[model samples]
Target: MTVGVEEEFVLVDPRSGVTAAEAPRVLELLKDERGVVAEFLRYQVESVTGICRSLSEVRADLTRLRGRVAEAAQDAGCVALATGVAPFARVSPVTDDPRYRRLADRFPRLIGEAGTCGCHVHVGVPSRAVGVRVLARLRPWLATVLAISANSPYVDGLDSGWASARYPLWSRWPTVRPPSAWHGTAGYDAAVDGAIRGGKAIDARSVHFHARLSPLHPTVEVRIADVCLDVDDAVLLAGLVRGLVGTALAEERRGVPLPHVPDVLVERSLRAAARHGLGGPGVDVLTGVPVAHERLAEDLLVHVRPALRATGDLEDVRSGLWALTARGGGSERQRALRAGAGTPADFVARLAATTRGGDLERKAAQ
Candidate 1:
């Protein structure tokens, strides 16, 4: 399967989570590696890898890309952080980028205040029919994936209490939640057209559903997960996504009817997942009973196990999940670091160190 990865990273002062739109300056220092760096917000830069079929290749590409970016940022006296939201990001700190300016002008209330980052994984679908089918099957499991990858807990200098505040915040935009069930490509195109004509959106590209058929690519894009700081976490999440899509495709081949879930149940389940992480209460979307989030996660994992094994990624996926649960996601780690350091600035400094790729090398060496 062809896979592509896009990671959004925050540019911040080494000691502060505040926005540092110094990406342009840092890019200048790197001699402009085309296809490697793309502009996100003024305060963020995104790195994308070309299509690769193997997990090992993906990991190698990402490690090289991240290391290069970190070195460039260090040369420019800045650091890049991989997280859903920087704790100190403020609307006023957004850099003056033309696209961002347009966004601010168009959706003043929403775009002006938005500063969350995320990772989007796009796996190629052989046809548009497959794309829609994969998206439909993917919708029900969005919340579980979001919970497993909850990395953004603090926003605007305080804990947002939600394991991934980026989820709730990103859901504010119109057409930005989970995808609705559409029967085929024609139905999907019609829906996009109607939304545009009815002023619900500007164009087909604006249909920013959490898991949607990519207008620009021949793939279904999974956009709900946070930008994980640990490279292992990011890789594991991508592997799971690949497995899920593969399973959905297999089910489609078997002529399995796509399950119809109530929208209200999906929303409720997502909210609970965001609030509790894996340690808190999670609602069973099928039954609406409150249960442990970890149990729900396990059930979801079971459904995707065959796919995981087929992809030869079950071990890595399980190991990565264990690492997150044991050491805590980015939020918990940030909280622990803050408690020990006694200041947000200190915590951010530690985060910068962690993201520099040096920490992983040190761990391996030890």
Candidate 2:
């Protein structure tokens, strides 16, 4: 199976939360690279890797890609951040592009102020039927993943009181929501057709479920994670996703029926995850009872261990999750920095310090 990742990063002014339209300039510098591209907004750029089938290869590719992009952005007098939302962004700061402009015009209220960064993992599936099955099985687990990886804590100059404000804000779009449980390909196709015919989305391709069958690729796209600041974190996330997809496929082959989770319960779990992150308690999708985040993560890891071992990624996943627990999520680190500095500028400067390329570190020391 082939594994790929796409990360949307924000180009921020080092001192202010203002968006920078520097992706074109940065892309020019990285155009010679293997897997870097511009995102929908000028302030955001995406980095994808060539097909990777192992953890080490994925790690190397992601590390190199991030280093290159960080170098380019620094040269342009801007710094990039991997967060769900910038703490001080103003909605008016989004660049004036045709697509953005159209979105703003059409959904004046929602689109005018919805710039958020996220990471997406795409793992190839053999067929649409497998993709649908993967989506069905993965739906209940989405909020668990989100809770463990909730890195967005602030937005638009205020504390959003949610670990991932991006999830809630982005979910406001009429067409975007957690996918409904589908029995099979027929049910999946019917759902897509309804969404398109009702004018809720542009086409079958635009169904923005938390996890979905990628219309443009022969993969299942996991779209629930916030952009992680550390390349190691991102790589680990990619590994976990690959393992999960592999596990789902195995279950299908074993004739295991996908678990059923009610839509309301899914929404509630998502909210609980966003609000508490892994810091406090969250609702358990399986039990419908509240439980500590750490316990839930441990349970999840056990369930997916076979897939992890099969891919030779169990160690990476275990180590990465351990590191996160120790260092805390990006939101926790950002909060600590903010408390110490007492200003957003200082917080951003600290972020820039952490995001600076390792290659640049050597040059700067001279």
Candidate 3:
């Protein structure tokens, strides 16, 4: 299956460690660049990769696009940061778009704090009906995915004691939640229609389920992960999500029954994953019992092992998970930097360096 990735980033002034409202300038510089676009917040920009079939292709595309955005940020007098929420709060004005303006007017407080960024993965499916089936299969494992990709630990310059504080902030939206067990395309369409009719959402785009059929593409979009600090982690997420989808598709073909898990239990697991990431306690979706985060992650790997091997991503995903365990997720890394750097300025400087391809640059230099 072909996969595509969309990553959002925050623009900040490296010296002051505060967000910068320079995305318009950055977007102008990247006008000639394909798949680079503005986000709802003026201080954020997004990079999208065209359909890719391999992890290597995902890496190459992200590396090149990240490099381009970093260079443009320099030209725009800002630095691009791959983070879920700005370490310090400074809400940028909404982008000059009518839709965003309407959203701001309709929900001032929610949109004001909606500066968070996330990584979205789109995996191609044959049809909406098949996509709905894949979404059902994906529901139980979404928490594990969130845990693995947790990158937001700070809110308003303070440690929130959650691996991904962005989850709660983003969940403030009325329609944002874990998707329910949908029967088919008809059921999915009904839910979307209901959300709009009931005024819970402005439109289909506003139906922000964790996983859904992409309104603009023939794929299943998994919208659970925080925007990763490292390009490798982003690639790892893409590989694992694609594997999960592949496994689901195989099961569908074989007429395997869908696993039964309560939505409330799944939602609880998501919250636990957000609070602890991979280093603390989490709820297992299958058993609905408390389990170590590491164990949940292992279960995900085991569940998708066949698909990973089939797609030749087994080794890369395994090694990537090992690296995460050794070095930690973005939350752990951010906390370590905060403790060692001694100042917010130093912390943001180091963060900006990483977001701007410092590690990739070092590898190339060596």
Least accurate stretch of 10 residues (summed lDDT) in model 3? Answer: 357-366
Tens digits of per-residue lDDT for model 1, 1-366: 778888888877766667777877877776667545645366677888778787777787777778888888878777787778877755444456565565566566786447788888989899998898788898778877787777888888888888888888888877787778888888888878887787656667666788888888998899888887767777877887888898899899999999888889888888887777766788887787888877877787788889888878788877777776777766676666567665656667666656655665344223
lDDT of each: 0.76, 0.78, 0.88
TM-score winner between candidates 2 and 3? 3
In the range 158-238, model 2's lDDT, one tens digit per residue, is: 778888888888888777777677768898888888887886766565567788888889999998888876677787788
Superposed by TM-score, candidate 2 places the C-alpha of residue 167 at a distance from the truth, in angstroms, of 1.2
User: What's each prediction's TM-score?
Assistant: 0.92, 0.92, 0.97
Which candidate's TM-score is highest? 3
Pick the winner on lDDT between candidates 2 and 3. 3
lDDT of 3 at 185: 88
Residue 27 of model 1 has an lDDT of 72
How well does model 3 score by local distance difference test?
A: 0.88
Clashing pairs in 3: none
Model 3, range 1-366, lDDT digits (tens) per residue? 999999999998877768899999999999999889989899999999988989999999998899899899989988888888988867669999887888787788787689999999999999899999999999889998999999999888889999999899999988888877887989999999998898777778778899989989999999989999888889889989999999999999999998898988998999999999988899988888899988888888898999999989999999998888788888888787677666776777677767766564344223
Error of 1 at 330 (Å): 2.4
